[model samples]
Target chain A: MGDVEETVADVGEFALIRRITGGRPKGAATLLGPGDDAAVLAAPDGRVVACTDVLVEGVHFRFDWSPPTQVGSKAAAVNLADIAAMGATPTGLLVGLACPSTTPASVVDELSAGLAAEAARARVGVVGGDMARSDTFVISVTALGSLDGRAPVTRSGAMPGDVVAVAGKLGWSAAGLAVLGRGFRSPVTVVGAHRVPAPPYAAGPSAALAGATSMIDVSDGLLADLAHIAEASTVAIDLVGGLIPVDQRLIEVASALGADARHWVLTGGEDHALAATFPSASSVPPEFRVIGSVTRGAGVTIDGKAYTGDPGWQHWR
Target chain B: MGDVEETVADVGEFALIRRITGGRPKGAATLLGPGDDAAVLAAPDGRVVACTDVLVEGVHFRFDWSPPTQVGSKAAAVNLADIAAMGATPTGLLVGLACPSTTPASVVDELSAGLAAEAARARVGVVGGDMARSDTFVISVTALGSLDGRAPVTRSGAMPGDVVAVAGKLGWSAAGLAVLGRGFRSPVTVVGAHRVPAPPYAAGPSAALAGATSMIDVSDGLLADLAHIAEASTVAIDLVGGLIPVDQRLIEVASALGADARHWVLTGGEDHALAATFPSASSVPPEFRVIGSVTRGAGVTIDGKAYTGDPGWQHWR
Candidate 1:
């Protein structure tokens, strides 16, 4: 938006950062913000929950396919969801961006705008970060959260007979990915879901308050993530096929693509949905839908049957 | 360590991560360790100082010149220094490593070993991380620290007449760099210093307790970093050349290479020494040496004269 054309190399790293953060609003929890060596965020609960995620060009997202802003938002959102999954309230984020010197400054600006927008939506602040030069674009984000004095909801807490429930939509992101992979021209919602996830930010602490026995963010598909809970808790998980809450758009898109909606719902990931186990006699939270139950076994099964289909998303496959 | 000769690609990202972190000793502060979505750390002070740093291949370090261990240690050290600079004690670290699919799992293990060793030295735990495939190797580390309820010592607090002092060795890293650049193989100490910096970690909080007017970690050159303090505090910094306490190794190497040791001492960065300003009349801490004074102007000058040499290291230049 400036009259003059200048590259990120021309402005240098520090100046570029100052320009990007200028006039940006910092939240109340940001005791000391970006200009310093590190940011000080108010914990309020004597504990901090932290997580980090890295997105690489071509490997994670192609610039030509995903806008810089969407990439930025997704990068921050996934990390935030990890903290949320720990039953913590979001507080602040630190971003590490590696891009080629030839990258347009405008792309970086849009990325910042997207990061700021997502942080605001999550009610967190962009506290501090480091920028560096690289061959390909890479954005690594670390999100910090406050536990609010509650015990962290861990995956190993689930016991036999605990009811399993999910707090957000599933299968939509995987369907979105399928549509994007197929280069479908119609169905904007499916494509949007793939580009930028809408993780249920408030549902994590809510589930904790509702007495979640064990929890995890749905990253490596429902079955794969649940397998983590199963392994940690040393219990078997049984999901009811009819209980998976999926979007209609995903069903329609999957049908049109000749792909199984159940496969997408079960093996698809990146939705960042919070799935947890609760006591069978306990009341479920309003935001959660009962989808499964924990049993006295060693692995996860669907409808009391072993799933012999695809495993899940593998990072370096 | 095992009979399996699996590459990172062969094992896949998640599996490789599980392998690397499986038997490591998690620190006391890590209540919830690596398997969870997010790691929870004890923040004792109701506040955390957080920061992230990205080190990219060729831009930040060269694998040929720096061993994988050095790369891992330096990456963790820089991020931990940010926490220390905030007058906080680092508690935990989250690492994100992006590497080519063909990278050996052994290398990943050694890198993790380096990270663990560094975190131990800093009295922090390596909590959790993400691994992904990329064309080049990049390491992104986020460090979390506890402020212990003490008010953060910021760069904007220096006042006129405050004595500018630095704790720990200066120019040793830069001198070590010069030694490595010239292919000097005789002195391992110089090479080791260049590879793994020995920062005075405890001096940061000590400065805060001694009532430091302002504080910063000298990641950039002394003159350039001091300029940041000046800009933040609205004061000019005047360095007294006679007072700088540099290592003798730097002098020997500089003399051998016909380089100016003073220049290295003043402008060579990455030593990660804690630089702070204290009241002129107060007793200087044992770990620190008074090297300059804050004045009523802007920018930094050396003995009443502006520097005419290289400003400092430039990223990707």
Candidate 2:
């Protein structure tokens, strides 16, 4: 730990911000990017979908555990996932960073690099944001997205008999976390998965095009997130454990560590995977795999039974 | 402090959030407010101007000195003011709050009340937001506004010979802070001004309608904020100090306290006043008063002299 010479308070805020944002490529949709009073993004379809989230150090991520780049990338990725959950293509992002003055300039630059890398990966531009002073490091990001003439697939639109499906891998993130927690450093794949997530960037709008009735990103686990759809739509969701797909690497790791892979698949969070309900007549997108159906019920169930291992991660709890 | 009897950790994150958001009036623009994966706001004008800011306790505010309501109101007010600075009518706001688990529930409730009260004053709805655990209290807000068919008055439009004007009070907030810092609790007016700011909410769009060339909310001090406009537009701003219509009461406070009124007027920040430049021929909005003029040069000056006092408040400084 002493290997780190100085902290955030050492480098200062504005300089760190300058270092972070300097020389980053901004996307075309960002008519005006950062370094202004406010940023302006082109909303070609005339509508913008907005979402915000704040991730705090220690509570959201521990600096000792997560590298600076991972923190920045995850912050942008998670917020963009929310925009995608609304069945809209993300257009731009605004980030608010609060850190001590002594923070390393390199850390701040790496954070910006992570954000730019992730933004380019998602094809969304980072428009604007603010930097402030805080004792503990915190990053608050607000994502703006374009609807592109597509109807927003709200959470209240799911109906009975609608197919429930997911796009992107499940349980890999949580499995990776377990490996890290146990101090298992040798498995590069597991460690890499734990550090950064790859949310299905295209599947959100593709599901919308496939006529998804309701959708949400799986950041808080399959059961908990699906429960949101069920409660909002006033329908029940039944997920078949057999139909649920798992990453083979995650399965091997879980079995090797005497952990239940199904538990991780059902209860692990932070994958940023998208789960949506669609009409039976609609064809599932290539990125999505059908696993269950909506029904007339009050909550979500896994394999005809309530999950007893863990409910999932809750911010308040 | 011990008399407070509880901390953020004692109340927990989710329960406190539910309490904070319960029964507050959400304006019509909100399709869904809180309790969902993401809240939706109506953008009838087809475009949304979005901005975000984060405030941290000890760094941005002091709980012991400022009321919870004041903290809440200030948090929303500043963000809404940014939207207004864009010459857009704010549609909705989302707040992300992070507090220690030991924080009292009443504090959280009061904070919520402040947010609701300020939102009502700004005429913008409070949509959904995120709540999490943190060691210190942090409030992060994202404000969304609708342009209402008008082109946004960016800071880049100031031209030579443009008249610079302001709507709303300045120096009062700084004066108020002085009162708090010195523990001189005499004038209730100054205290109230510091506790909760009264931004010129209507003046932002009014300036746009009046054909103002460029505009910004005075978050930093007058000279410093104008410097931003000057840099962005590549024009010099010459202020007529005598023309700045500061409240005489502030002068009295400064005199009584043996402080410089001009210092407060030039360097005091957090007023949320709208500052803009208009072409000489353009009609000045009744809500704004001309205080300066744009010229061919660089940076901001007062009475043909460089303001050498202080550049204004900066985060992490």
Q: Which candidate number has the best lDDT?
A: 1
Instruction: For candidate 2, write residues B62-139 as lDDT tens digits.
Output: 887789999999999898898889898888888888777777778888998999899988776677677787776888
Per-residue lDDT over B169-207 for candidate 1, one digit per residue giving the tens place of the 0 to 100 score: 788788888887887754788777777777888988888
Q: What share of the reference contacts is kept in model 1?
A: 0.87
The alpha-carbon lDDT assigned to residue B94 of candidate 1 equals 92
**Winning candidate number (TM-score):** 1
Candidate 1 - chain A - TM: 0.96
Residue pairs with colliding backbones in model 1 are none
lDDT of each structure? 0.85, 0.82
Docking class of 1: high
lDDT of 1 by residue, A1-317 (tens): 57766667877898767655545678668888888888888888788898899999897777776798988888888988998898888998888888888888888888888888888888887888788988878888999998898999999999998999998878878887888789774588777777788899899999888888889999899999999999999999999978877677777888899998888888888888888999974567888899889999899998899899899899878
Query: Which residue runs of candidate 2 sit more than 4 Å off their true CA positions?
Result: A1-15, A18-22, B1-15, B19-22
- Regions of candidate 1 where Cα sits further than 4 Å from its true position: A1-5, A19-22, B1-5, B19-22
Candidate 1, after superposition: displacement of residue B232 in Å?
Answer: 0.6
Q: How far off is each candidate at the interface, as Cα RMSD in Å?
A: 1.0, 2.2
Q: CA RMSD for every model?
A: 2.0, 2.7
